[model samples]
Target chain A: MDLTFTDAEDGFRAEARSWLEANVPAKPLPSGDTAEGFARHLDWERSLFEARWSVVSWPERYGGRDASLWEWLVFEEEYSRVGAPQRVTQNGIFLLAPTVFEFGTPEQQDRILPRMAAAEDLWCQGWSEPDAGSDLAGIKSRAVRDEAAGGWRVTGQKTWTTRGAFCTHLFGLFRTDPDAERHRGMSYLLIPLKAEGVTVRGVGRLDGDEGFAEVFFEDVFVPDADVLGGVNEGWGVAMATTSSERGLTLRSPGRFTAACDRLVDLCHRQGAVASDPRLRDDVAQAWMDAEAYRLFTLRDITDMVEGRSLGARSSLNKVWWSELDVRLHEAALELLGPLAELDGDAPAAIDGGAWMKGYQFSLSGPIYAGTNEIQRNVIAERLLGLPRK
Target chain B: MRFAFTDDQLLFRDTVRDLLDKECQPEHVRFAWVDGDGRLPQLWQSLGEMGVLGVQAPDAHGGLGLSELDLVLLLEETGRAGLPDPIVETAAVAVPLLAEVAPPELQAAWLPGLVGGGSLVTTQLGGPLVACADTADLVLAVRAEQVVAVPRAALRLERQPSVDGSRRLFRVDWQDDDAVVLAAGSVAADSRDRAHDRGAVATAAQLLGLGARMLDMTVDYVQERRQFGVPIGSFQAVKHHLADAMLQLEFARPVVYAAAWALATGDPDASRAASHAKAAASDAARFVGRQALQCHGAIGYTVEYDLHLYLKRAWALSATWGDAAFHRRRVAEFVLGPPDLPDRPSRSEEIHHG
Candidate 1:
């Protein structure tokens, strides 16, 4: 197997690296989880949009360079390396855009993707209700026909709506048939978050920011123009979103590799901690894990290119990166010693408690998308041919 | 770039796997372990005839000239079948080592025998004991960065039995200077270092195979062995355990193959790559082994059953070239810079000797 990049890929990397070096903001943006910070993050995304750097993997019509998967990976590495601000539009561009591209009509793509590229239409995922988390098919949210209101009216509660507090729209699964049981008659609908009957209450993450929210919908009207795929085929359509969540789109190896490097830098700054053998081994393990994740991501890309359905392997990727994320941050925090516990502004806080912030965020990884426990069940039953319960 | 194996390599792996399935059954393994010196002479001859023995030996030595990447699948399949042989040593390691660094006369005396399937060669490259030193015609020993070709008859042997009974290891008492010096100085050091890297990668690949085998066995066991009222695999805890094992094996696998490829391509980071592979594979092996045994409940611990075979082999090979801790220290040195902790000297020596 060839791990080396071709000359063309190398050239693309060089171009991406140079552009990112020049274009990244001179100062760090505010935390994207905060209200004001979210706006600041949007401005940066707008800059990227003008320069066609917001979504390089998308086609030219969606304000992208039409880059290949490998080039997108390279771009991610280059973008994150400069300590660039996080992508506030990732929910729309990375997670939901693929479903739109694959399942939505040409008109829907033209209407939604361009605004998403320009960061004018940030999106939040509407999975994981208070009751229906890992068992996504148990969703109780309903979207009944409202002929008088001119379309479907959605009534439900969507918890853990990542970026829901400040987002303009949401793409969620709504049960459309009263007679159909679980996993049937489900419709995938894209609704405006500011519709008349919608309410979004911010839910605080470990970092004490309203990074996600509990979105309440009471007769929120959604036109028929925005329903994705077929009425009862939402399970199949949403399965693609699950793949996007677990695979390259959500947790790219570039982000972790960059974290590993940052972790090593922190260790070296610790002097004595860097020299401790146990901590050194932990550092080595972190690097090894990140490198392994990188190679595994490459294998995933190759498999997709070869026309093999991702199938159960996406669950494998989810388990891997989520654990690695937790481990790498844990190692970094452990190396930081007593300073690790301090908040960002405390005098004793090390690196502004970035590691602590990251540690908290990392803890959510295995729980969100799908719990690692559930992912393991998928691996056992589907991949290992274990009998279904 | 393609990260998966080529069609040809997949076909080769299948052929090796099919052969082992037919010839290396548990009874044959038990028979070799209980009744003989544990060397499958006939299988060894067959491998040599297939050029598996000389895959890396130079063209002049009547070899296949294949690199570590080609031999890794063969070694993996061997590990899966729990094959009791040192073809990995004789073919994958010794022939290549001798061809690269053996003294001219030593090469003349052994290389032809090696490629022609008439002779078996065991190896001891900085490991504590020699594997199959008693059964092989020659033992390639390394000391002070020098490669020596020692005749099995030249030394007194004390049998050092491994936890895995099929392995026949020995503590050989011989004069280092009395043996044939294949090469000395920096050239010898380079050649021996190369061999050690290849050996470590080969061992890591084998451990991965062992892990995969145990995972398969445990998944099957959990399905067939009922508990409460249904197959235990249907239980959440059991499924989670097997899934975790499968994840470890999957993660370790790409690392193992990438290390093999790095060694084949002579990447400057080949040493670090092999260490990464070894360390990861070691964890995967132990994790899979533990979970497999636990999942088997009562039937797993008994030697009378098949689970013990792969479990014991997993334990045996994880410590062969370099164990998890050993390779982790090496990797630490590579990635974290030189260790400057209080135990720096001891850690340095541990890395240096291995």
Candidate 2:
């Protein structure tokens, strides 16, 4: 059980560290939820694409270095440490890109991935609907065949569409055969947001930002060629995306460890909390949790590389990181005493009140990808073989 | 960078598991309370014959010379089986300490015997309490900055019966100029810290196994035990309880494994890693144990069932080397700052959920 990196991995880390140090934005980018912020973040992603730093783990043909999992981890470590702008195209680069590489036809991969990698086009998820959030199989979104137009007309509404207002494309589930059973007869489709009869209205999030949108598809035509993983098997295809969403592609342990470092630095800044014995251990545990996640991810990567099937355990990873993210941010607030309540722009706000913004952001972790409660149910029924209700 | 066990290590774990499965069943564990000395002597002997007792001893001592990582699964299996013996204290704690610090003649006299099952060895670590001191042939202990091997005959034991019927703890009162000093100054201090770390990591691993056992048992119970005209496992509350337990155990495992590896490799972060393992596993075990029993309802409370074994073992093991709070304090010292301030439970809980 070797934990240290090899020379090659060390060199990769060094190269990443150097490149990030040199080119990363000197100040934090604006929240990508805003139009101006989104554009700037997109430009940051384009620069990363030029340097092949955007998707280091992907194969070179997909505009990546084709790096090993270890190197990929190293890259993530550096990426988070530099406080780089959040990946504005994560919906495309992480969730849909993996699906495209795995299940997309060569034409789809050829047309979609490079542009996605370069952030020329942004993507958003279309799985959740007005009535179907946790119970996704209950989605009533329908797409009927248009044989003459050689496609399907999709009609439905998808809510909680993250960054949907700015995204140009979406990948979502559509009920292809109305007569089919639950979780069946569904097809995954890639549709342009600007398609005829489609409208996206931005939804304000907890931080009063439009990080998400409500996308309505009214007889929007999606080409048959855009169907993923074949027809009536969108459930299986979406499962792949969910796995990536909950696992390495979406959330990296490095992000949490970096938060831990910042939390530690925050505690160091607040000399007042030093006398509180309880907070001291709480502070220590924050770091321990971060390190634990790091080691856990390495173990996961090792198991994956060794041909071990990554299974329902991703639910466990999701719960661990989501809770850690929330608790870590909370710990920062607790250590900050009264200052934690300040707005980020407040004159007396600590760390620019990033912790306050982060706390609200962290709550979204438990709610997104899949709720922690749902993940717990999955762990119980699927992993533990408990009887389902 | 492999994180999984080697095939040989896995085989060792399987062998220990097979042994525990056969010999450490409830019938045998019950014997500790019914007829025996609260020690599974036969399983202890068999572990010795299999060289499991010497897994961490050096090769020169007629042992396996394995590191903590290799022995971690074995210890975990022992915990899973609710093995009532000083297996961890003998192999992971005492033997390693003596092998690393004992004088040559002292080592020759006791190391092989300790490893080969001819004798038992235990330690008084972390606290003044000496577990299994009465049953041990030799005891590794510390006085000031010196580490000494005190013979069992030199010490008087006051028995401390625990809620966990499987374990027998004792306070060792000793007077011993005849004790053999193994190392002094920084070496002794190092050996002392190493022993404590090993004990903490081993205890953490055992707690993990105990938590896992409880979780698996609770899952089985919830599946068969019906309420409201359906299996209770179908209930969201029951499922969530068990699921929460599973989450703690699952996440704590990597920390335990990583700590074992850190101590084994003598990494710079070994101290913090050991504390991390102890803190995480302790919290997980306590959480899982309580939740498991709660899910089992009244049946889990009765001693007629085997649930008490893992639950009691969890309680016993969690406070063995260091409890969650204690280890967390240690972790705080290393990463946060001084941990010597008086603990305020109310404020602690507030900060805990804060």
Give the winner by DockQ.
1
Give a tens-digit lDDT track for model 1, residues A258-306. Answer: 9998988888899877877788888889899999999888888888888
* Per-residue accuracy of model 2 over A147-214 as CA lDDT, tens digit each: 99999999989999999999999999999999999889899999988889899999889986789899
Computed on C-alpha atoms, the DockQ of candidate 2 is: 0.67
How many clashes does each candidate structure show, in the order listed?
1, 0
- Docking tier of model 2: it is medium
All candidates: DockQ: 0.79, 0.67
Worst 10 residues of 2 chain B by lDDT: B345-354
The fraction of correct interface contacts reproduced by each prediction comes to: 0.80, 0.80
Best by lDDT: 2
Instruction: List runs of model 2 lying over 4 Å from the truth.
Output: B339-354
- Report i-RMS for every model: 1.1, 1.7
**Distance from true location, Cα of A264 in model 2, Å:** 0.3
